[model samples]
Target: MKSTLKKLLPFAVVGVISGATTVGVQQYFGHTSNNEDGSYFTTSKNVSFAGMNTSAVGDDFVAAAKTTVPAVVTIKNYQTKTSSRASEQDMFDFFFGDPTGRNQRQRQQQAPDNMPSGLGSGVIISPDGYIISNNHVVAGASKLEVVLSNKKSYIATLVGTDPNTDISLLKIEEKGLPYLNFANSDNLEVGQWVLAVGNPLGLNSTVTAGIISAKGRGIGILGGQGKAANPIESFIQTDAAINPGNSGGALVNVNGDLIGINSAISSTNGYYQGYGFAVPANLARKIVEDIKKFGIVQRGFLGVSSLDLSDDRQVAAYNAEKKTNLKVGSGIYVTSVTDDSGAQNAGIRTGDIITKIDNIAITDFADLSMSVGSKRPGDKVVVTYLRNGKENTSTVTLKDQKGGTSTRSKADLSVTEKIGSDFDPLSERIKTDYGLNSGVVAKNVTEGSEIAKIGIVDGYIVLEINGKPVNSQKDIERILDKYQGNVQVKFVDDYGRIYTKGFKMP
Candidate 1:
């Protein structure tokens, strides 16, 4: 009995030591949420809010402003101007020579040198120089420049842009720079004190304070008229005095943690009237990581078109037309489900009311949109809905826009595959008439392809592919061969307007 007791004592001691080690490690590392949408981080470190007590005793913002101001940068966009006057025959003859009388072809108009088009702000979110800015700030830019608060400047490389979310990722060749850390926006409450830091009206390093006015707002400012398709707007509204140059600025909490990216303002004069909107940090963080990893956002679609229950007029009309007693502000009414979509696969049918996504209640469309927008394809979500006044839950496996359940890399598609069009060598007549050295004509452009999506039609002349001259199909293939990222194509549309559009490989 004494020998058995001695042996058990050693085992008990070992078990105690092991348990102590686990508790210590957990205390240091903290409890991280394993969300279905994955995590957001700048480095390998887990996201933490250890000291982020929003209910703390002070309203002082000096420390918060000081911590965040140095990280915001002013972004300048330089774009090449295509003169419309060069397109008309009279103006063309005035600029060059007349084409009818002379057998010689008119000289092609030279594009004007790139000029500074606009200015915005950006937030450095990493010590290694990763920046988050609005996509509209960098869209159509031939060159981008970033100026730090210290008056130092660097030529910025656009890693990727998602116009859907109006978020862009940029990089500068620098190290050990000051940057802001992301905070979970889901933890933010209404009336919380926050700060907006940016350069406004050419004013550098300006900071303003305000409270969170609202959340889950969709203002319809993003999509339409040849802009971003399928725009996602779930903004954190604040009265933070955001201005023209504050478009891509930082919206931080009183603790100096980044909670949102300053994006749009609700104003009639284009200046701050009272309220401004910001893209939430959780969504922005997801976009930044996606752009850094895949060169494109891995957006997951729920595959159902629904009406927002918050709109009383629309809901009333829907209820009356459908002869149902659906109440306003209840949930989203599913009108149609896309074929072969995750919702359809999950057995969600028309007339069903979507009540919840995971644990979040869907009172508005923006709530559901933001919940799904932050997730990537192949991520599973537990969806709760109501069918005929009965609640049901389904585990849905989300899919990409292409209906694939797998993750995609930019290298997955070749240039031709991305363009989805065939190329043929330009005719001798076209070459001589346009005074072109080399060119190829787009042919058999497939519908729903990137080329067609960008409004490129059949017979559009391609002068350059990624800044390299392309005279034949082989030329395009060679230039874009193994190119695993964004490709810029210089095209001469039917109106002779030169357009330099960008597209991703996948």
Candidate 2:
């Protein structure tokens, strides 16, 4: 019995040694796996490090906060107010009648009997004082005041703005500014850490951290309240705490590179409720370049209306409607193709399922919109679609809204399109009544058009635009083509009275 016990004791000692070696090896590998570059990291709690490595290595967001917060600035939009009262809430501020004391203070500060002004945020993108922000932040502002992180204020001039993407570019008369560098948002994976740096609730340089909950999110929030008529919404969704004043702020990756611009939040109370949406940096960068160079967005259109196949119920409905679908449903199901669109030119039919673009999978409508929206007209893209479960690829050359593949110069853009007015040639009867041989009639005035603000109504005859005759549509287009700054429009009202109003080009 003594000999047997001795042999068993030796075996037990060997077992203990083996267990100790195994534990040491696990600890070493676990600690080595800790990422230092901050590209991506897994939760330490979920990883069993033999209970030895317990520190939170990937949870600290200080490095990202420090890198991004300095590039974000506060924007004050100063615009004309029809009503001279302090009752209205500031734009990008708290909701109207917000009970918070902070909100009340902001209302008192911004709503003081003066021009209707609001405060928001912007991110400096260039060292020469080129800042990019949401168009709503500076839209309709006669003057824009930008306050940097150092509290230095500059009266910025509008470079250009695109309402479709809700992106605006402002330039200050300064150079060598600290700016946020752009990162490719197309490579951003779900669950990657992202830090939002902005001025939420008027608090400047507020930094919040969260994971990329989703990509290619379309919430239909932009162009709301009749701001942008045709809104392009392809948002990067995150769990970041983005509130008012966070718009145009930088959403940086773990490496402190700009991935997105915080644009809106999904909440019933007009505040952040765990869901914040941002404009992808890729698209925003393109819009900014277009606005700065061409004074207009050169958007590429795929020209196909389609539905996403994310939900099982929607897939089932689509299948029921088609009456021919067998099973596997993913990507977008093309419903219709626009006439003379890039899709039509590429021979993309209604029954084709768009699966990929340039090697990137199209999971939803937002993905397709962004894929085409990211490029300018005249740019080409490779589209891969599945027809009857057979894969096919087409290299599609995208076209502009005018169905042209050439870049539109500033002079080619029409004033009627910009001012939102439908001008028609003056009829013989109206011409005779107005005592004018050649004039154009404002057939229909858009509700939110700048021409509408001039008090010009439908049936009013435009006698002269910018001191030029309005005898034909070509005349009007030629006069206002790429025309910037103030344009004096003289017209005879329906009451046979002459009215002249000076409207600054937006």
Candidate 3:
């Protein structure tokens, strides 16, 4: 009996030592959560919330979920296309296989009926029904429907959209709705606990918790053809299990304040691969505010072609291109300052190393982009740079893409504002010479305007709208006010050039 008792004592001591070591490691990493009786349990090691209490990170996942889930909503985008019957050539090619057997030419004529509905998520930003969402989610959408956590639904209108930041503003008629306020994403630190609230994969009111894996991360996605035209991507990287349909949802801190908006994920198989990206709240808030106050976004451009020094490969390429032996380092390198742009106008020369903006350190191109992208045109920024190893400073006012320091606000203008154009009456003498009774002249061609995209410039006189005569600016408005997707605009320019352009309304 003594021999058996001694053997059991050794086994018990081993068990006790193993348990003690596990608890010590857990406490150090701050994965402790509270139970009902106030005892703590360790579940993870990545989250840490120091300064909140003498205790380790609080496991307040339930509190954040309850605060945010009600404001996150599912958005359904309904789009329709006119079905086109096969042409004789298409029919012949279908019956008898194409010569290349690839159907490349036939693919170009694809006009299908009832494109599949696209789904995403949105975060309500105000009790008066202003919601912030992803531009890609609702862009080109003919109809938008939002469903809340309580199962109540509402029809939403597109207040304004900015593809550059991939942020869109929407409004519903309802008042006193649940909303989440913005937190300073610039203040968010790495390893801080955060929660992602959204309807991912059609799972409504889902909340996932993780740590802020990184900040000022640029994934090299967005900003191209068929995507954001002038993409601003300085993503807050996390591992919060965001999936499809989480694009426009909220990424909140432990205090339930919005730190970011879940934008995209880094994966090879189209699923979470431990890397998810969010648009920082600071930049998103700027975009939402601009869209709300102005009819369009008031983006500020620094106007300098730069090399992202954060990337070693980009550094090597830049060195090779310019034949300079500069070392790869943090912050943005000014390769060339665009002529007459904000940078050049402010005397920012080539070969300058931009170190700070408004006193905030420019750690990388992402930092610079986010800092400048958040400001509007005509806003002044203090730029600190290194020239020949000496630090110098300059005050530069930002410019719009058109090189103009101006702001755009919505007027009680024609509905054609959706098409990004303003229409005015043509002069009677010119109209008589053109043998026209009345005509609406398109003016103020925005950079990305639909009419401008179809090769029509400002001063083009509109003669027809969808085959109906457009005698006045209101005529063009009345014809397009009810049209959802695209309409045909036939016009004549000042150079006596007659052309028909297709304008798509956003």
**For residues 112-183, could you state the per-residue lDDT of candidate 2 as single tens digits?**
334335567899999999999987676545568899999999999888777677788999988888888899
lDDT of 1: 0.74
lDDT score for candidate 2 against the true structure: 0.71
TM-scores for the candidates: 0.70, 0.71, 0.69
Off by over 4 Å in 1: 1-59, 83-115, 316-327, 414-506
Q: By summed lDDT, which 10 consecutive residues of candidate 2 come out lowest? A: 10-19
Evaluated at residue 119, the lDDT of candidate 1 is 69
Instruction: At residue 235, give the lDDT of candidate 3.
Output: 90
How much is 374 displaced in model 1, in angstroms? 0.8
Clashes of each: 0, 0, 0
In candidate 3, which residue pairs get closer than 3 Å at backbone N, Cα or C atoms, i.e. clash? none
Error of 2 at 420 (Å): 4.9
What does candidate 1's lDDT look like per residue over 1-506, in tens digits?
00001111111101000001111232322333243343322254654335765334244588898899999998876644532211122212222234355211122323336435456789999999999998767755557889999999999998877767888899999999999999999999998989999876566798988889999988765652123566788999998777667878999998899999998776533346678899999999999998888876788998999998888988789878988776786678899999999999999999898989997898888888898878999999989999988999998999987799887877675567566677999889888888888889987654335665454656689899889899888888788787678888898876577889777764
Top TM-score prediction, candidate number: 2
Better candidate number, 2 or 3, judged by TM-score:
2
| Residue 357, candidate 3: alpha-carbon lDDT | 99
For candidate 3, the 10 contiguous residues with the lowest summed lDDT are 10-19
